[model samples]
Target: MKDIFTCDLRTNSKLPLGGKTIVFGGDFRQILPVIPNGSRQEIVNASLCSSYIWSNCKVLTLTKNMRLSVLASNIQETTTFAKWILDIEGKVGSLNDRETTIDIPDDILIVDSTDPIGLLIEFVYPSIVENAKNPIYFQERAILAPKNEVVQEINERLLKLFPGAQQEYLSSDSLSQADFVHDNIDETLYSPDILNGLRPSGMPIHKLVLKVGVPVMLLRNIDQKSGLCNGTRLRVIALGKRVRKAEIISGSNIGNRTFIPRMSLTPSDKRIPFIFQRRQFPLAVCFAMTINKSQGQSLSKVGLFFRQPVFTHGQLYVALSRVKSKDGLKILIFDKDGKLTNKTSNVVFKEVFGNL
Candidate 1:
């Protein structure tokens, strides 16, 4: 009764004029709007899923895949249709312009959203500096997930094996307020100087980058021109504010420490909606987001998603190809007959394929 009757409907017909995303989903051939079964001739429609609407996208076809035998055709139809929907992204090249890429030296940092961030410390600066390829190096490895609980567990286990390893994290309340950038959520970062001697939040995340003691960038989450909607692919980019003092949402008349030195400002533009006026932070350069962050993004390498629930090979291909070339790409998951091919372990295969 929910998805069929009382679900939130987002369509060109249902939305207010000038809405950014027209998320229209329905098999017009079978379902009718409002008056059910009272249709004359139904249509198969997703007209709004057009190149003019979205940014970076790739066309993919999961149907007629010879990877499956004739026996699975009937059951596979729905999955294929879903894949078709995911693959029909029109004119997505413009979307790639959103992500602001920060080119920090590789040795300076290695970012991981998974558990056991301490494992990174062990992997890079071992007690005796050995090659990373040794199997003994991976003996304490565990799957990396974004949840704090999971990461804490991995860190705890790793501590027992490697007593010297230190777990690192940025426990900032301001930057970590929202749990997701998904769905229809409007988000903005404000750096107001309302309180004397007060600083905007995002200190922890700032410290995360500062501890590295290297030049870095910051990225914004919202795309002003494109407009942000639920799952509308919003991202913020930053260049040198990674470890700077940011007084975001200030109550006083002061800007973040990064405001003057890092982000060169004309004073007025630094107010709200920094996109309007001409302002550029020297220590920072930011773009929106690319196809890579949809699944998620990493600093250097990534395990591309190409499994069943993830559409077709095209999405995986785009995700994998986001790097300079194949050198930074690795297949993390794959599907065989809609099941994961590598189930025993989720160790992301690292490869410097000399492509990206």
Candidate 2:
């Protein structure tokens, strides 16, 4: 599909629609794209890019969030409306007292995201696979990390994960190899295809995952009740088009990213995109609570694995929000298990997150 196939959104005014089908998404409040020479103006949004063109596209607004409960979702939708017109700063992720004082359960999945591209694929490729039955063909619908080394690792891992998976490893400079082309890492000027994309060395795994439409899992911080330490899985979404210095965590690097596979959210590679956005860890366990990744989609079947539930409010709310009704929720903890009496110690954290 010729995505940027010059529809000539160039109109009477830039925002004046040139026969457009711009299914625009993403928040203008978040990260901005990193253009060469790094001008703040370069990060400007399409909302501002050519309001004229956008002003003309056939309008269709999905004000309703499918994931949140009728009440929470409605409240949020109303808030979005208020924010849309009033420009309220109501979107606050500022840390609170609960964040610092809260103590969560141990055994949180701890991961170190070193391989940027592989981590991106761990999250992105799955969703892409879900939507694009054969991704190699939909070359225009994807983004590639700049680092060739990271890209190489990703290709190897993808093949390892799905032997016949169709994908193209690309780079800017003319080369037919799968390795880091640091010299051409900033080659975003060219369009992405199965064959062309570049990335920098030591890219941040988080950004890479987000760029490729995958969520990220960072051990936000350790909250422990006993002798164990735990991590948080916060799936983030960039508020803008693209940026530089991406951070990613490759699951193929098992020795690096630490995950308690039995307690993490591991959506199959083919089922990720429908998740909207989530903390795409290399591996996820059967019954752990997931993140806001469920924001835009709906699920018929979901399994929730939770126990002492000592984590951030986001973790709790996100986990609870995964299922549509009480029947879709399942608990995977053993309160009667020995040495776990204190495991329930993370109740406050769980309660706050659960209520949200």
Candidate 3:
């Protein structure tokens, strides 16, 4: 970026950023750049704070909670909730001897439920069958989990409760021709069945089952100008062999209907040995989404399902801060014995905040 700016502006190459000012905005309290199998030190090293340009960067902090400020009726309650969220972000409260575990308040914790996941779904999406066709009902509500597998489980359970005829779409999977030829790998090594089973991050699943009114999220950014970017939620309107029509349920393009055709998508995960392609609809059932994917989104109602405790920095803070108010958030946590508990792990890499 600096080189391009220097050439375009006819400035000296030694000038910082070609004598042009650039602003970077983000919260270090949220998830950092994901390193597949990296250690604690490696993950921190990959952050922008560790970059050379960071030394020249001036840090600016925004202390206001604008989302809570919008609620004029509940100023005190929202202020309390906002402060609690920041306390969790900075690990400000009492901690366990290891300084990793924190106790959750009882008001928002769902306890003593025989079927926790079912109860959580009902709390977030009440009257699922009746409101399945209502786009507005799904627009401001979502369930968040720490892992993709937990999210898939919640989505499947919710889909079963949804009343409609299910349409199944199977993806066509194969190794990329370039990878196959360049690596000189035999085709039989990775059979179609094997390829179909691999569900890499940021790629849709092999078998996608959908109901007409159920909400789905885009896995790939198809058209940004039309507000069809990754993490955008939509409601399925029509199903076809080649394309699926959906109405945008969230973001700036709400109520805009668009056709999404089956496209080829490849996973960008480096842990995968070779490149493979899957031709399928670039969408996933989003009755629940992973916590990492829920960042930068604010919703009226959010369900935090803890199938397991958070294992990385800021996961707890990101999950808790998604909702607009404390009343809009509900959390369900479990111990190894399957009993509901109010204690959960909060992982924070304090070293990242050293320079700040």
Candidate 4:
């Protein structure tokens, strides 16, 4: 910003930001900006509030969570759960020690489940096929998993439950056009199988199996105004060579049918030194979605499946708060060790919110 101001004064003899007013609003408790291969100081230095202009900024806060007031019934349970979520999120639990594990409320926990995914599907989507046509029905429920692999497993299992003929779509994976500029770039490095393996977690896989009436999520933001943004949920209506038709099942644009065309996708993984692109439909089965993807969505019924304990701050809180009412949530916490106890892990980096 200082450089930009200096450049403006040097060339145009005018300061664009000299008298301009700026306003910023956000919750510091939610996920912070993720900087890959960055140090703690580097990440903290990258935040907006860390700028020199922050001293001139005024902080105004909205205390109320509108989610609690919108619940239809079970106000008491919702209030209790909301506080519990806040307590865990703010590290105000009885065991508030930073290194100690937090105890989850017993009522919200599910145990003795050999088949957690199956139980979660049946619990969240009972009579899903019969009520598939109704967009509202799909909007009210979801399965939130901690990892992409778990989400994939749950989605594949749930896809089989949908009553329709399954259609498979394969992506055309090849070396990126940019790589052709390099004379020494090896073609074997861009093998389709290897490229598929290199795709990032949130991206659609090389092979996507879809059935009509099954719910799918947009992996990329195609049309935000039409409710076809990333994480937007839709039900498959028709499959085509170049475009697929689906009805928006969630958000303000519900019941609207939209055509999805095959688009070129590039994974934003820094681990892969070479750039690769895949041309395929930007949709993934949404029977289950990662907890990160479930952040902005509000479902009446939510199944929290934990194959592994949440390893970050506010993850447990985010998953539990997705539902409007406490009764709409059911959690299956795995006993990964032989402890056989329900425990919620909260990873709070006190330094992130320290200066705020």
TM-scores of all candidate predictions against the true structure: 0.25, 0.25, 0.94, 0.88
TM-score, prediction 4: 0.88
Better of 1 and 2 by lDDT: 2
Residue by residue across 179-296, what tens digits does model 1's lDDT show? 2343323335333222111222211122221211111233342222332211121111122333233322111211223332322222222232222111222222111112322232
**Per-residue accuracy of model 3 over 163-211 as CA lDDT, tens digit each:** 9899999999989899767998888899999999998999999999999
Put down candidate 2 lDDT per residue, 1-356, tens digits, no spaces. Answer: 33332446345333223445456664332222323343333334322333434434444445543443433435654454333321211123433323333222232211223543343343334444454223232211121222234233443454344423232221222321232243444334332342222222111122232223222333322223321122222222222222211122222221122222212232223421221112222211101112332332233233332323423223333333333433333322324442222122111111111111
Candidate 4 lDDT for residue 307:
75
How far out, in Å, is residue 284 in model 2? 11
lDDT of each: 0.27, 0.29, 0.87, 0.76
Question: Model 4, 203: alpha-carbon shift in Å?
Answer: 2.2
Off by over 4 Å in 3: 1-8, 11-13, 91-99
Write down the RMSD of candidate 4 (Cα, Å). 3.3
Best by lDDT: 3
lDDT of 4 at 85: 74
| Clashes per candidate, residues 3 or more apart or on different chains | 51, 36, 0, 0
- Global lDDT for candidate 2? 0.29
Rank by lDDT (best first): 3, 4, 2, 1
